[model samples]
Target: MTSSGTHTVDAVVVGAGHNGLVAANLLADAGWEVVVLEATGAPGGAVRSAEVTAPGYLSDLYSSFYPLGYASPVLRGLDLARYGLSWRHAPDVLAHLMPDGQAAVINRDPEVTAASLEAFAPGDGDRWLHAYADWQQVAEPMMTAITTPFPPVRGGLSLLRRLRTAGALRLARRLVVPVRKLGDELFDGAGGPTLLAGCALHTDLAPEEAGSGVYGWLLAMLGQQIGWPVPVGGAQQITDALVARLTARGGRISYHARVDRVLTARGRAMGARTVDGSLWRARRAVLADVPAPALYLDLVGAAVLPPRLVEDLAHFRWDGSTLKVDWALSAPVPWTNRAVATAGTVHLGADLDGLTGYAAALARSELPRDPFLLVGQMTTADPEHSPPGTESLWAYTHLPFRRDWRADEIAEHVTRMEQVLEDAAPGFRQLVVGRHVAGPADLERENPSLVGGALGGGTAAAYQQLFLRPIPGLGRADTPVDRLYLASASAHPGGGVHGAPGANAARAALARDRALTGAAYARLISTANRALYP
Candidate 1:
């Protein structure tokens, strides 16, 4: 272990999830001595996998599907296979079970997928090919920007270069349009809208939001290109690989260390004061991989925060809360529409109108009469995830962020969800041998950072993105304090297990060190203040 007093290194990273671990590994690789602090005994806040319900069954603590994982440049660059991480994709990407006896199955093979789509609506399948080609052109560079870090100048420029080579004018127009508009423009049919809406729902944004259309298009296309996969074991493999890489690069991890407050000396953030009364001072910088409110209100403290920052924090908006359900099934789900049985992911909604109504109800803080569901058949996706002959499944739905969900309401909702599956897959209820439910309150209990049980760290709406994320003025990882940076999903290029925020924070801290030597740390405080206020 590196001696703390004699050789204080470059950065101190809080949290050991994929993002924090990735940042720590990157800094260590760059020859900086990195130290990671985690609040929980285990790493990977949302990416954890454990045998919670049954002794042998490994359940994903939060996120399970990983189409994005394969597409991530940082993960690919790290080559996580060096650290015992491997991934497997489902034979088919998804199965959308309609209220009617019809279903759609999507696969990686364009021919097969197009065939499936063609079966639904003739030329719509060919339309998919055209859309996919356009998607491929934008995906690589767009992903690079979203996952690169705050401001994403390099990634943005790279995307611009690609667009210019392909069709700059067309791409530019697509960038500003809402996803719903894009879908309508391309495919003027129910199938296209239904498919695109499912993709857009993955983020916390509505399809009508400007920047959200890109996410919807990118995710759906990525699923087509690389089937939505899970790590052979679980989501933990991704986090473990990151931790292994960081440790291999000489980074240290301290668990059960909750940061009480960020400490500053002469207006420069020096380190953090842990809840246990121990202070761990950073020689270079402090990276906060927790949420924005936690970074600003809990750690940074109002005494240090400028007035504008306090006001900005007051107006931040969180997305709808979510309800997650995990089921242990004795028999395979019997979909009335047999095609749904073959799907790894199943989206449930009556129709486009039903989905829109669901979203509207959520916005108004009312439980929907007809809910839209995102379901994952875990055992189907990766057989090893559960005990033999038994299926494991995970499903979730968005609810009004703060609407009260009584025990009875939760039970009713779960029953309805099962009925939804039963409508498509009769006898779905009978297949369930065991069940565990995680409501919005439960999510908040698990990770306070997911305040109000909002995933994607507050809404991804146009009003809350990019320069306006978390707060209006300061969205670039740097906070209103010196050497302190927000490295969570709450920062720019928001959420979804991407390490952009942490990477951006580390880069800014490194940049500060380069600009003014030891004095650079002090400049961070002033600059952060200006950014937060301006």
Candidate 2:
């Protein structure tokens, strides 16, 4: 029999994604009676691994390659390894295929990577090395500030300290400059711009967008430093590990329990009402890991939101459109270039024009004649992801976020993507044994948090980042109302499998639930930083 009671918990987490899991784990560790409510029948939201097409062949449903995953200090604190989590990297970092049979391969060894750039342009190798060296001066602290739950003052102080030691003025310009401009100014070879642009395309934004080049450089350099790695098993392994950890600590998760509305009492979130009209009360607070709009508009009534916050939410921009295709291949993708065979990730495009054209097409709400594809050859990175001699491949491309293409049109988009690959590798399509496709609508159906099918919750544009995320003045996880916090990609510092939002929300919740355990709790946070940062 289902247990029904007015059971009150110390805190309630509204979603069971990675961020929510992080917040739940931290709070549970802090001795809070935490209960996690998940919309799906499982945890991990976008970070899930499943057998969508065939049995024994697992696919990372959303997030496959994780450069940020390894860089996330928040996840490190969880000691996921003890709960059965590990990582594996690709042999070659990545490969950028050009139109004229020319390719630039980023090797794990920075020297080899620089040499490849040198082959394309004589002095570019030296320039690339210099850029990386300069990046090293601030990369550590910069990552700290960006990911940590620092307020404007603390955040600024962190940035200033990093910049002070490493040329402030130049770093300032780099932060403001559009990615396209940065690429043009830094790299002087035919390979340079395309390589930089391909990396920028990882997000839904165009390379011409301001502040986007940083992501490209950060990710590319990160791949060089630590190759793009996947979990030893599949993405689900990460989720399962988190679940294992939570259960070990006497915490529990309720899957297929979609919380329809957040229960409120006297203007503050009290608990959540499930889709079945049942309510679960929380003694302290409720943390929501769903998208900001979904949380504010759907779960909580719009009237409850502050006017300014509502206005700001109206302006939040979801990233460009995405169409995902997962393939069950009989054999590995045969590339004419051959080097890409060993590479885990491939950025497929003819040249800069081709990429820019792809973006332009999206801007006009139309699919490009030849879409630039970000393909993840999963089996190449984790061979155990599929059966022997077979490969699992997934590719996604951005389109106009609102484009409503029909089935035939989507087929054409897939055709164009295949054409781009086939141009480099003849007979590329023949290797496909089974295939599955998901457009914006399908993505939303799979995970409601991907509202409008937004992968990163919302676009990572400058206007939407930091103080302006979700809405202005709500940056520190806490909303206008006390004890009601947002712990999702929609919160500060934006998305990825990094558990910063979750950790941030937990800290805020703990601080609010004080007085009773003030001194005891104070001692714990002092050491929490060491665990998180170390």
- Stretches > 4 Å off in candidate 2: 1-5, 150-159, 403-405, 516-534
Question: For model 2, how does the per-residue alpha-carbon lDDT over 467-500 read when each residue is reduced to its tens digit?
Answer: 6786655367876545678999989888788888
Angstrom error at residue 201, model 1: 0.8
Worst 10 residues of 2 by lDDT: 525-534
Q: Candidate 1, clashing residue pairs?
A: 335-425
RMSD for all candidates, in order, please.
2.8, 4.9
lDDT of each: 0.77, 0.80
lDDT measured at residue 387 in model 2 versus the true structure, 0 to 100: 96
Q: How do all models score by TM-score? A: 0.93, 0.93
Tell me the spans in candidate 1 whose CA falls farther than 4 Å from its real position: 1-10, 403-405, 515-534
